[model samples]
Structures are given as C-alpha cells and as structure tokens.
Target: MMTHTETRSAVLSIGRVYCDLIFTGLDHLPVLGRELFASGMEIAAGGGAFIAAAHMAHAGRKVALAARIGMDSLSAGVEAQLRESGVDLRFVEHAGDAGPQITVAAVVGQDRAFLTRRAGPALPATLDAALDWEEACHLHIAEYATLHEIPDLVSRAKEKGLTVSLDPSWDATLIYDRGLLRACEGVDLFLPNLEEAEAITGSADPQVAIRKLSLAFPLVVLKGGAEGAWVMSSGRMLHAPAETVPVIDTTGAGDAFNAGFINAWLNGASEEMCLRAGIRFGSLAVQAAGGARLLTTAE
Candidate 1:
C-alpha cells in the first residue's frame, strides 16, 4: 500500500460520496413507458471527489477524501470498492441522511445519461478538519453544486494557504446561474467539460468558449473528450489531442482527467504536459466500465 502522512503533497478532495449503479452497452435509452436492457452492469464507488481522489491515489499521490457517505444498504454495496481505492477515508463521514446518494448511469454508444438522488446536504461536516489538515497543500472541489452549497469554500481554503481547483460538474439548475463565475472567484484552477464550458460561456465553439473562460480564471483547462483538451494560462493557450482507446463507459472520465491534470500541475509540469496527462487518464477511464475500475488493477 502507498504510504500517507509522511507525504506533504496531500490533496483534499471535497464532495459527496455516491454508490454508482452503472449500465452499459444498451440498445437505446429508456423513454416513457419503455423498457431497456443493458449488456453489462457494475456497482462501484463514485462521486467526483472520490473518483478523482482514487485516480490520484492510484498515481501515487497521497489523497484524502472529504465527503459524506450514507449508512444505508445501498452505501454498503460500495464499501469494499471504496476501501480498495487507496484513498484516505479519515475525513469521510458516515451519516444516515448523507446517502442513499446514488447515481444510475446508463450509456449507449459514446453518450451517457445519469439519474441521481442527492441526499441530505452538499457540504460535509468535516470541512473544518479537512481545511486544517497539516499535510494538505491543495483543495479539489468536485462539483459546482458543492461550491453553490458553500459559496465561501474557495476563500476558506485560500485563507489556510491552500491552492484550490474547481470542477463545474454539470448540475442542470446551477449551470445557468449568472453568478456562477462570481461564486468561483478565488479558485486557482478551473476544469470544465465541453458542455459545461459552452453553457458557461454561451459559445458552442470550443475556441471561443475557452477564451471566455480563461478571462475569469488564471488557469482554465477544458476537457473536450475525443477532441482532447485545451488549456489557457497567462494569455497563452495550448491544446492536446485525445489518446486513442476503446470506449467501454464514459462515466466519470472527466473526473479522472482532473486527477491526471492536477497531479501534473502540482508537480509544476508545463501546461502542455498537464493536458497530455489528462488525456492519458481520460483515455484509460473509457476503457473500463467505471471511472476508477482500471486504476484498481493498473500498474
């Protein structure tokens, strides 16, 4: 097992912990009064924070998960997978109302859709302990919803001298908020997928969308799926093409990409290198049924 605590490069990944029920290789998406069958299924530990932390940990980073997990049977289903992730779970709270936090992900071809149930509150009770964790140097907020629930999170992390990164995980309601950019004011890095970027910038064009996002963030890296990724920093922009790999499931690929980019960025890697690392991780993610599944057996 990888050692912890002795490493001062720990990352605090804050978000909700979920039990992901994934279904892949479907004939078509289910519609009203219709039934669909999937060729394969898997139960795994999920949520943006956990998935990113797992991938980072697999890459040899000392990552700690700061989130809430439910005590229900549904939560039990993912317990072994969570423990196997190699993430520091000390900061994870097991609360009654915290879960049954579940996501039903269905994938068809390269497209996917999710139906999720969010329980209790978005912010975890361990926020104070996590922010004050002596080994932590960076904070990775998993979703915009978490930021929306705790608008002052970035400031809180900043006050503790920790660099912060935000991934605007798609929330239908919060994505269109006019104050979204304002809510992200103190974030050091902004990672958003193509759809979220277009929604935020009101531009379907990737080039224009990234440019608009770059103006607000010091570092903006946009995940463009098969087209690869784009990064803008200090008025300079760079793009890295995606790695070719078979697609098994697209679930959590963006979050996996975040881990690669962050791991590289924390090491003071060049902007181009960070983009390539993200692509590499994302490509690996799609070759499996769940976000961190490949990392479980990865060498």
Candidate 2:
C-alpha cells in the first residue's frame, strides 16, 4: 500500500474535481422527449485532475490539489472525498460563482458521451495565486487551457524549476486549431488521446504523429482506448496493450491511465515502465464502476 506522504517526489494537480453522475447498463439512448430505464446509477467524485491525483496520492507521493469549487453541497462533497483519498487540499478554493459542473453519461463499457451545463467560465490559477510552487518536486496542470493561455503560469512554474505535466481537456479542439500547438514548449509530459493528437498535428496516422510531438518534449503518450497506449521519446516508440476485462463503466479509464503512468515516472521508473504501469492501471478501471473505484480494489 502507498501513503500520501511517501518520499519519492511532490506532485501538484491544478484543475477540476466534479461529480460524475453515471448511469450504467442502459438498454439504449432515450428517444427524443422520452424516458428510458437505466439498469443502475452511481455517483462518484471524478474529474480529470481529481481521479488522476488521487491515484498518484495512493501510490505514495506528496500530492496537492489546486482547484476551485462553488459553495454548494455537491462541491463540498467532492472536497470531502478528496480528503479521504489523501490529496492535500490546501489549494482547494471555494468561489461564490457557479457550482462544480456535473457530467452526466449513459455509460456501458469503454465509451460514453457526457453532457455538461454551460456555467460561468473557470478562472485561471496564475502565479499570483496562492500555490506555493517552491515546496514541491513537480507540478502539473490538468485541462486548464483557459489558465495556460495566459502564458504566465507555465513560464512561472518553469522559472521555479519545477517539472510540469499537462492534460488538455476537450477545449484543445478550440485552442489547438488557433495557433496553440506551440503551447507544448513548457510542458514536460504531454498527455493526449489519439483524436486530439491527430487534431493537434493534423496527421492522419497517429503513429507518425507521436514521433513528431516528442521532438519538442521529453515524452508524449498518445492514449488509445482499446489499443492501450503508445509512447514516443528520443526516437523510440513503445506500445502497451490493454487487458481484456468485463468493463462496467469506462468514464475515467484514460484518467486512470495518466495516474498510473505519471506515478511510475515520478518514482524514477523508465519510460517503458511508465507506459506498462499506466495501461495496467487503466485496465483495472474498466472492471470497476468509476475511475477512483479501482484504487480501493488495486492489488
């Protein structure tokens, strides 16, 4: 078992933690203006940053979360779960603006489409914010295009001599098309899906795309859902295949993969080890109901 205060390195996760409202084993999508029966429903505290950092925390690292939540019950509940998961909540902020977004999905196995309400825009956690960048071994930002666009936070973290890992949310589609490709300069590890990688590079073949992406950064892990994940760095490409499992809900599978991959790398594992560990953890995610659910069940 791994504890939160293990002495490997420091990890800071700055991004989101929202209530993932998931419906599983659904017969079919509901027709227009009609109701359909769901086999079961489960609510879990999940988001790209939350689940990723939580798993890393469980894997023995000093982890802190930099996030903003509204003054609502669900928001408070999400915070409570993070505390239980052993993530340091010192950077967790409460704003009076919009509540945390709720992602609703009709998930069965390894894929689902989520619906989110348009709340007010999320603010950035710039260098002027309350984060203590000097007290950590590494820092990460997740799905924060709005914040990184400022160009201040990334440079500041680099100035502080902190290694950075970044996960771009779907907003990359909007940001990448508009001259945002060079944003990869400051990031150490670039995590993106196959589709996003293609969009970022305009490459029809993702295998060729990963090689080009790694030239700018030390590593690039193009996450493919069923094909596992592929990594390219220093002119070498490695592939990690996924395990066959009875998938219940795959809402957070990719997030789990990021957690497993980064945690191994932070612990001084080789790039090859990181990719395999990531795929191993992600395979566990599918067998469970939610992203974080696999943590308690991991051997």
Best by TM-score: 1
lDDT of 2 by residue, 265-291 (tens): 877777878888888878887777767
TM-score of each: 0.96, 0.89
Number of clashes in every candidate structure? 0, 0
Model 1, TM vs. native: 0.96
| Weakest 10 consecutive residues of candidate 2 by summed lDDT | 1-10
Tell how far residue 231 is off in model 1, in angstroms.
0.3
User: In model 2, which regions exceed 4 Å deviation?
Assistant: 1-8, 118-121, 124-134, 144-150, 172-176, 297-299
Give me the displacement of residue 38 in model 1, in angstroms.
1.0
Residue-wise lDDT of candidate 1 within 5-80, one digit each (tens)? 3446889999988888899989788999988888899888899999999899999888999988888898877767
Q: What is the lDDT for 164 in model 2? A: 77
Off by over 4 Å in 1: 1-7, 296-299
